[model samples]
Target: MGFLTKNKFTLYGVAAILLWSCLVALLRDVSELFSPIGGAAAMYTVSAVFLILVMGLPKLKGFSKRYLVIGTLLFVFYEVCLALSIGMANNRHQAMEMAVINYLWPTLTILLTIIVGRKKVSLWVYPSMFVAFLGVAWCIAGDAGISVNTLANNFADNPATYLMALAAAFIWAIYCVVTQKLSNGKNAITLFFTVTAVSLWIQFAISNEAALTFSINSSITLLLAGVVVGSGYALWNQAIIGGNLMLLGTLSYFTPVFSTVISALYLSVSLSVSFYQGVVLVTLGSLVCYFVTRDKPQKYNVKVTT
Candidate 1:
């Protein structure tokens, strides 16, 4: 209670993290119910409505032109890539794999911070990155274990989904870095999400997907997903703008584990032993990255102009 009273933004960040952990599973289900682009369109449409009802319209005044233009573009693109990557997976099981890939953002975020912020880091950075990438490869390798052949084959089989998921990882990393630097205490999350919804709808309109036939359960899932997605972003925008990014990054280290567990259970799927092994490696890599730079001072300046 006392901590919450003092550090409410941090709590919001934690809440956002928890909500986002459920994202992969919900997205898979939603995509199963509606087609990929159509379901994503519907979910973000509900997200836009949910945010408007709760957060009111976005105020665009007083934002840095850089933040406005770059932040909006990055946020919108990241959200689209995130939705499409998982939603387009070949199967529910593959969707779970995509969750692992998307979580590469945590490590990438730290890595980008170290490089872009020009912060000094330990030699561990190299090994940490290797372990992280290796984890992804190993995860896709499944029972075959990590190998160049298996890893390449895995991606070859689903080039579009895998490429989108990988792009989402890097895009999100850049977004986290850029948004924190230029937010100026203002969050255009409502605007960004609204744009994302529109973008998704446009994609859906052009695609042949019929939005599938929604059952009662799927409809309920979509509503719940919309609520989670909307509130999660609203809270996350607050969090990244105010809370400790390093601490949040540290906490995010566990996202893949949480996501895999939730996704497997929610989707009623099984994962191979290697997949779990890869998850651990990926998490440990980020943990190591966190350790290397935990004591470094925040280089980027933040303000609450709003």
Candidate 2:
């Protein structure tokens, strides 16, 4: 059973990474039809429709009002911020510069858990956090070459992209914390639908500037995005449930690695020397967090019964 679970989670991690890569690649294509806002709107709109059809109105209506409202609003903001980040970065190099910045979240999440959940951090936690922090600093310094230029050249420039990425990370952290608190044994499917619907409405409201014309490519990409979100979340939930989160988080570093590769292949993105350096820091630092942090749940006994 243990071996089977491990193998399954290993596959889940790989699948999650791949799906994210595809989603990122698709975003580049979709960005052409509408601004990041429009693309996000389209994505959630499609997701909403998909959920209504598959899950039906009655089941979707069964969710708690709190879940319906908070989950949707949080994720909507996350998507919008994410799109803005991508728009600002524009290129893989620039986008990744901002992206590596967000590697801070996993490390910071421990401290956040400490503060919000009032969980005590183990002694080993600090060392890992420090290592991860230094790693993030290294990544920032290495990528500072591009970030500085972008910031200096245009204030309205891709600074928003980096800011958006940071915002997304922060919002995601909050969402994680809140979801754990609120979603005890809740129906993930219903929660997903509510979030999608609410987020779509938000996106549509904000995306007045978006082009309405749906090209064949954009439509195809939109469909792919919906499928990826729907399927990928299911698989990722399984992974977290079955595998050790510490180990899985360590493995999940491969997401950006896969993103870089996919960008290179499809988007014609070239890797910079500094980018590779950032990769090393992100990979190694995440591993440090995994190893140094206690993996066993007995220490804290966080009763996230959902």
Candidate 3:
């Protein structure tokens, strides 16, 4: 955390934000063409393949067996839930609920840290939690033009969409907790590949109806989303190795911002003032929680290279 307080760390963080924004923008466009399940299946399958190719070489050392096993299991749940949520969403607007809900991970991680690791949390943590929840309430109340009537119709017709979002949020929270405990320098890269591979198999097993079709454009997006973004997640571990937790956490608030922007620009989804306000409040509240807390070094001993 101390290392991350420097000028260089801020620059790298800005670069990460830009990279993530571009990735979300691309996903917003390609999602229209491919079936969510199909695109997700393709994305993770390609991700697994990419991980194997990158990590299978003899020069790279492998992860600890125990850490690899646990990481793979948690990641399996996370990816499956995420893909299902994306698949279930009718459009980008509905799909974004996943992002909004998933950001709860930071708060969840803090709570889980207290519960599982018996860590002492700062005083501001609980208030931050309430602020985050208030953001959710605001979003739910806002006039994004989505309605309870529409949601009811969707629930009656396709319970999968909403159910998937809930499942994704829960699983991702679990993944964050597990990562916080097990992540360390040498094992990080190996665990990244193992998790991606395991998640691919889990998704495959759940969705047995497999037919393959590809277009030049869709295929490229699949690669970028799966390979690039999936690997980008691994890179994120590197980012945190010496980066400011407060700044890092705050910058991640940009994911939803990017999601909202791409949805508006490319997907032609209108941005409601209420929705933006809700997002802004949620993001600001999270920042307040992060910056106001007393400084602590990352508890886990993690190191990364490339």
- What TM-scores do the predictions have? 0.89, 0.76, 0.76
- Candidate 3, residue 244: Cα displacement in angstroms equals 5.0
Q: Per-residue lDDT tens digits of candidate 2, residues 1-306?
A: 887755887577557657765556556556655656666667756656665565555354556677656866766676666655764466655655555555556655556666886755567777766665555445445545545554455335556676777777777667666766666645455455456556655656765664567878778878887767655555565555555554455556556566666766876767667666666666566556545554465332121100
Worst 10 residues of 2 by lDDT: 297-306
Cα lDDT of model 1 by residue, 36-79, tens digit: 88888888889899999888987787688899899889877877
Give a tens-digit lDDT track for model 3, residues 1-306: 565556555456555565555443444444455655556656666655665565553233445565566766766666556556655566666666555665555555556656786767677878887887667556555664456674466456546756655665556566666655555444444445455555555555587545556788778777777676545544554466566655656667556566566556766667678777766666666666655543454543221111
Question: What local distance difference test score does each model get?
Answer: 0.81, 0.59, 0.57
Residue 270, candidate 2: Cα error in Å is 0.8
Better model by TM-score, 1 or 2?
1
Query: What would the TM-score be for candidate 1 when compared with the true structure?
Result: 0.89
For model 3, the stretches where C-alpha displacement exceeds 4 angstroms are: 1-13, 21-31, 51-62, 117-123, 144-158, 187-210, 241-246, 292-294, 297-306
Q: Model 1 misses residue 17 by how many Å? A: 1.3
Q: How many clashes in each structure?
A: 0, 3, 2
In model 2, the runs with Cα more than 4 Å from the true position are 1-13, 51-68, 117-156, 187-210, 238-249, 295-306
